[model samples]
Target: MKVSVVTLLQESNVENFNSGLEVLKKQTLGFDNMELIVIDQAESKSEEQIIELAQLAKKANVRVQHDNSLKVEELRGKYISFFDFNYSTSPHLYKNLCQEMDKHSVDFVSANLITSIREDRNLAGAEEVIGAGVHAMTGLKLINKESLLKMAGENKIELSDSFIELLNVNFYLRPFTFNYVNKQFYRNKFTFNESYVNNSISHIRYIAEHVDLSASKKSVSLMKVQLLKHLTFLLDKNMFTDNLSEEEQAAAYDVLRNFLGLVSKKEIQSNDLDGYTPLFNMVNKKLDEEATHYIKLLRSKRHWYEQTNKYKQYFEKNPYDLEESLSWKLTKPLRLFNKWSIEVKQWFYKVFLLTLAAIWKPLTFNRKIWLVGEREDQAEDNGYFFFKHCRENYPKEKVYYIISKDSPHLYKVKKLGNVIYHSSLKHQLYMLVADTYISAWTFDECSYPAPKEKFIKMFGKQLAKKFTICLQHGVIIHNISPYLHKDRYNQNLIISSSEYEKKIIQNTLGYSDQEVAVTGLARFDNLHELSVKKQILIMPTWRRHLFKINKSNFLKSDYYKA
Candidate 1:
């Protein structure tokens, strides 16, 4: 065969496979000289899907195989390309690119990919899709199968399992000819939320660390431009957002640090960064004049309720290390006074109100009471699911859901019996006496009327033995040990949907096997009886950088547009 078109498939993109198949079936270069290799990567391939895929393959006169059973050396094609399940290509795309590949004898060939095309711009000759593999859309590019395998052999990469990684790594491998077709033949057919900012930062670091200094001047300039452009994009679009967590802020700093170190060896022109200066003096033990002045200015502008975007312009060009200010030092006494005031009030609540509620301790002792909540103001998530299950199935059991009295969801939750107002007297009583407290959010968000630390401080050792369950809102697919760690959340039990997730909880969160259960989420039970819908449901997960933006800014974001 002259060409091998490999398609990546998973449960998420399986629906789009047939359309991609149609694009290939109508190829200007006939199927007699081409072979389609379908690699199914989905976890549990259904018999129906398998049969349907077989039928499609038979109709198209192509080959279909699971990723596990396929061998790279067995591939009959001379040149290899990829098929992005959600993208459509021109009928002659493969033929056109292959002709150029053959004529030029280039190792890689690509076209101008459309839809969210960031790397296509002229970035000082480096913009020809070299170290930006993560951003470069698949299916628009092709590589010589023999050369790819040869590179894999030299690099010790297993092409069958790590084909994608090999391809990404190949982008940085120098002395390989690359050809780019200016025609926009490949177009994305769908839009999805990308962890672009974080991914770009990672890719930039990778290229910066691995790029060859002995390469052409144009290549070195390209590397510099790529780094600067990616950093600038992130600074303008994400770094200035209102809702940056402390950890995320630190991560941003790390990226900046890496970029500074990478470019420090060479003299980068001021124009190369588009007038954005890198804060290279931040690592110095003593503050510089400019940094000191900036810190003082920021301190004077700081207020109790300062708007998030008020000092954005100051940070537009470069982010400085000004997290701590002189005002913070001066406010220590005032902060301690405020803390004392709050403690006194809490002491009063614990002494008087808690004493009053303690009278009903005997009543709660005889019965097992489960206090559940989601968002303080809403009845959703796994906590609500479990609460609903208990209320509906075991009417005699005591299960109380908490929602704020002023919340719009209060009326809806009230329809379900045994509901209590959030932070109310009754809520506090229940929190103190309940056998178990459960939430999809933090314990403070549901169980405690105030912060959990205050509750701990007020109750002391009395609340230590209380059982709390973390009915996680979603499946933990990535490492979030910082949030879920036992030292941070300190729940008795955590509900996990899969064994893989249970292991992550145990291994990363430092939970014992007994403490973490693979019981799955209670919400999954509700999913069993759901009516089938002839529609698509797209529930994109939240990104850390975009978490705290206001509605206006959110609506204007590229994430919202996508």
Candidate 2:
């Protein structure tokens, strides 16, 4: 079987590249069975320089690709091996790995790596075993191209070490065969680099996201132990102080903050490997003494709701006694007032909406209606999409937009001549004049009440004469509440994405097939038409109760980071 050896060359380190190429040429598997593919990732290299490198590879009977692209789409090999230019493999490594694989049906194999720290290669470091061949990167094994491609899907192979490790971890999590060889099959050149700290912490996040912490508890625990050891080693060697510049130190501090947040997870918190506790205690002691200023800074930036040792003790003893704690006791009156104000305001708004309905009953249904989203958010969702379409299609008809005073889109909304912009305070007047009322969220108080700013006194019953529509935010993933189907206030129309969603809305909102429209989400109409970029935006919702009770802890959480 043919084995493809792939190496990515990023820097202009010709000496290291030649060393790795020489080792590949000496593989015992023979040139006929093994093919080398070198990917040139050095963007600074010109066409002439790249051609020279390609010529050198060609002379060694190895294929060369000069593009920086990592999409290994058309690779020709039964098994693919990834290697680094700074690493050298044993001559018999592939031959032995193939022999071992034949004895057992395995998907991947890895061996211990001998690391040399000195330039002379005289002083050798201990052999490092990188987990059960799953977390292995430098000394990684050969796997079938089909299997690797199947797992990778459309995700491009990123140059980031953390991203590459995440891909490997994902592959290992699949129910596939994996093995570890005791022999050292590769030699890695160890060098001190400040960037390694960032890469290491990033890998920790990848492990947390992809690994099933419940099933692989031991693995995660060991990783945490190893990470702590690695950090201590870096600190002892003065890697953070001597090597990193001022800007680098600030960047490293940000990474450290993120790492601390990851370690605070429930699964990671429960595990404490042997020797880790002593190291942590020592570090804490050192930080308390030498890093007093840094500790003070951290405390200043921390949230008010974050519990301290004293607060924890108070919580354990007092439990339900809010008056027992100084902080809680001081805030109790304000909290009570806030609670009372919300109920009283909601009551007043309900009555006001009913009064508006009385005035609206005698007025004619104005074909020119208005639409707005929940709160002072942007005009990007279903409501905005539908509003834009209506204004463009029927220019003669009046389409009003009730924008929140604090909305960032206020300026943009004002520029649209076809659409009239009004503040939320004038919503009751618009409700009286408009024939239709459209919103992304539920308008009825029994379902989803309007925010304090957008409160229109009218309930569902009062707007019975108008064409009321609830252009829902998104498809429902969970079971819909039975209260929605009752439609106590009377929503005349409900929009759904598909027949499946329509059925769910029908069952939950008690709306028949005729009442629900399957016109697809209007917001997604021009999504494909817009220019896309190679960037990802993650929008995560916050827990309301958690923010209210433990705002400090919520601010420090990964959800807030996302």
Highest TM-score: give the candidate number: 1
Look at candidate 1 and tell me the lDDT of residue 349.
Answer: 78
Per-candidate TM-scores read: 0.43, 0.42
Residue-by-residue lDDT tens digits, candidate 1, 456-544? 68775656667988999998876776887899879899999999999888888989999998888998998888998799878676566
Clash number for each model = 0, 6
- What lDDT does candidate 1 reach at residue 130? 45
Candidate 2: give the clashing pairs: 353-457, 353-458, 484-509, 485-508, 485-509, 485-510
Every candidate's CA RMSD = 17.2, 20.0
In model 1, pairs of residues that clash are none
Give the least accurate 10-residue stretch of model 2, judged by summed lDDT: 118-127
lDDT of 2: 0.58
Q: Best candidate per lDDT, number?
A: 1
